[model samples]
Target: GSWHPETGGLHEAFGDITAILTMISQMDQCEAIICHSKGDLHAKTYFSAVAEEFGYALYGRTQGLRNADNDLTMSQVTEEVHDISQVFTGAFYDILADIFEDYCCPEKYDAAETLFRIGKHITSLLLQALLKGPSSNATFSDIAKLMISLEPKKKWKDMIRRQFSVRGVVGKGAKKVKAPVDLVWGGCHCS
Candidate 1:
């Protein structure tokens, strides 16, 4: 489906997200290094046990993130799914961050344990959102809207919307999809 822009990107994104969720499901939940170190703090994020490479576009020399934090608006995007996919991926990351921050270590909410639980919960939410949220030819905003509707508790609603908003994915004043669109040749188109 990479052959087409209207639908291919979402399918590719669905596969990528599903794969990440599946991997996390199989992984043994470890106490975040922060929790294990007593008080040695680290940047709050999904700490991959191995070198992770989901967002190839997100990687950089110093910090590796292809706007998965959802800082890039749709108006700023091109036609490439990998680049565009970061908007959703960033939302997912921020959701994880929100959960991590909200459930900070308490007597009841241990930091390490909360990290484990967040993985499980987010995996389910991501699956549900992928299956039930986005439409076939969905724009980023459409997926965002569908996801917002399916949230039973409005969990991270404001954050998700705000992320999508500035990126031009959705909100009161989203503009049109413009181009010189970016494209990935992926062998088929290379010849």
Candidate 2:
């Protein structure tokens, strides 16, 4: 209902993450689980074939409108929901990357299973945060603070803080993205 950078972005992130998670759920194997996103035309393959294409709005059917791997900051945000969403989404994506780094390597300790396990945990935390992470007029910092406050004191706790912190999503030190719409309309729109 309103136009707020912070809420809009967070809403976008929720859509992207949920779509990716759904794609992963349907696939039996997640070989490139850490880095695989083709953004292909095929409903089943786009999630795995196109890597790094996080919903590019240009070139329509060719790429995604956003990229979670993008290194965006407050200054880079364009006040667009998708653009702003990338910042927080990037942090979540990085957490997955970090988990991949930790569990998927020469160590080879059932990397696939570890990836899924960690992926589930990350999704759980994300959902928890979304459900009760922030309050009215929440900003990027609010997300981090809320999640940090609600998050259990476990190994990933610090990592969670660092991920958001690195992306300038945590604490009052970072720039604030404001506003929040009650309804957020986002979809593949993949021509």
Candidate 3:
């Protein structure tokens, strides 16, 4: 079967996700700490824990990632990561340009730019959390605490804390549904 961008077997999808995370860890200098002395064993353990804890927080699923059967050499991994990064950057900008063209409005342009900046900020905070946490057995709570501490605004810090406190509770409390809801579309929805 041909490879599809949106769907794949669980193992295949997990492998690709792990590869991307591995590359990111390498870029953020986490690979060095995880691979110190213990090599692939430590890397596997660290990444497995990260995938499980971080994955559960984000998706409410604990993925038990296994060690790569054929681990790439350090140099090889570095080269592959570099290539992947280049391809990803090029594709990202191309998509962004297409999006800007499709939604040609000053307000939409500002919103898109703001979204990109927010994504970058979140990525930086994740990397910072990884850097500050323990080399092995770093839980999501550790990362969340780091984020709370790093957040400048008290309101945002409180929000982060609240979010972390309810990591996996899916709709724990019932919400009051208001009757006769009004749907207002202010020229934003395409006719």
Candidate 4:
């Protein structure tokens, strides 16, 4: 549950502190809680003070996480963020490792890791394109062509009917296809 301040400055902070304090008083009865913020000292201090009140022991993990029994501080969260970054960085550095492996006889793991990153990037790009809308110039014909081009050949007849609403085909004084065909075939013998 989130509570917003009706009117006041740091008084809201006091209110938040009070609410958290009340919640932490019963921390033993609860399993865990997740708190999100912009990593400010005010919030960190509030949680630290509340944890201390609850007699929850805070421990620092080698992974850079600071845990207070069932709760985690932003410092601990930062550690997890760092771990993810390391993974991304390793994926990047693997490109150089691949070159060294083929040209300078390095480990095969490097090439495999680099290939994984390349594959991931390709899939992510395609996923993003699908999630986002079509391009500015995408028309009914373009989309129809794309659907037909895909494997298994999806029949989009209904989609075409709904999309293509042909109107204004018979302009002013336009008789019909039969009349035009007759005129073309008879030639200009009378005229």
Candidate 2, 1-191: lDDT as tens digits = 45567776777787777766654453354445433433211223344222334344444544455555556666677777767788877776666666555555545545455566666766776677767755555566766776666657555667677888767777545765444556667867889
Global lDDT of model 1:
0.55
RMSD of each: 5.6, 7.4, 22.0, 28.0
Model 1 ranges with Cα > 4 A deviation: 1-6, 15-29, 32-70, 177-191
**Stretches of model 2 off by over 4 angstroms after superposition:** 1-3, 32-57, 60-63, 104-109, 177-191
Cα lDDT of all candidates, in order?
A: 0.55, 0.61, 0.37, 0.26
- What candidate 4 gets wrong by more than 4 Å, as runs, is 1-109, 135-191
TM-score of 3: 0.34
Error in Å for residue 118 of model 1: 2.3
Maximum-lDDT candidate: 2
Residues 38-135, candidate 4: write the lDDT tens digits: 22212333332322433333343231232111222112222233322222122212222222223322254432333333334323322343334244
As for model 2, its CA RMSD to the true structure in angstroms is: 7.4
TM-score of each: 0.65, 0.70, 0.34, 0.16
**10 residues in a row with least lDDT, candidate 4:** 1-10
Q: Tell me the TM-score of model 2.
A: 0.70
Candidate 4: give the clashing pairs.
Answer: 65-76
Q: After aligning candidate 1 to the native by TM-score, how far in Å is the CA of 133 from where it should be?
A: 4.0
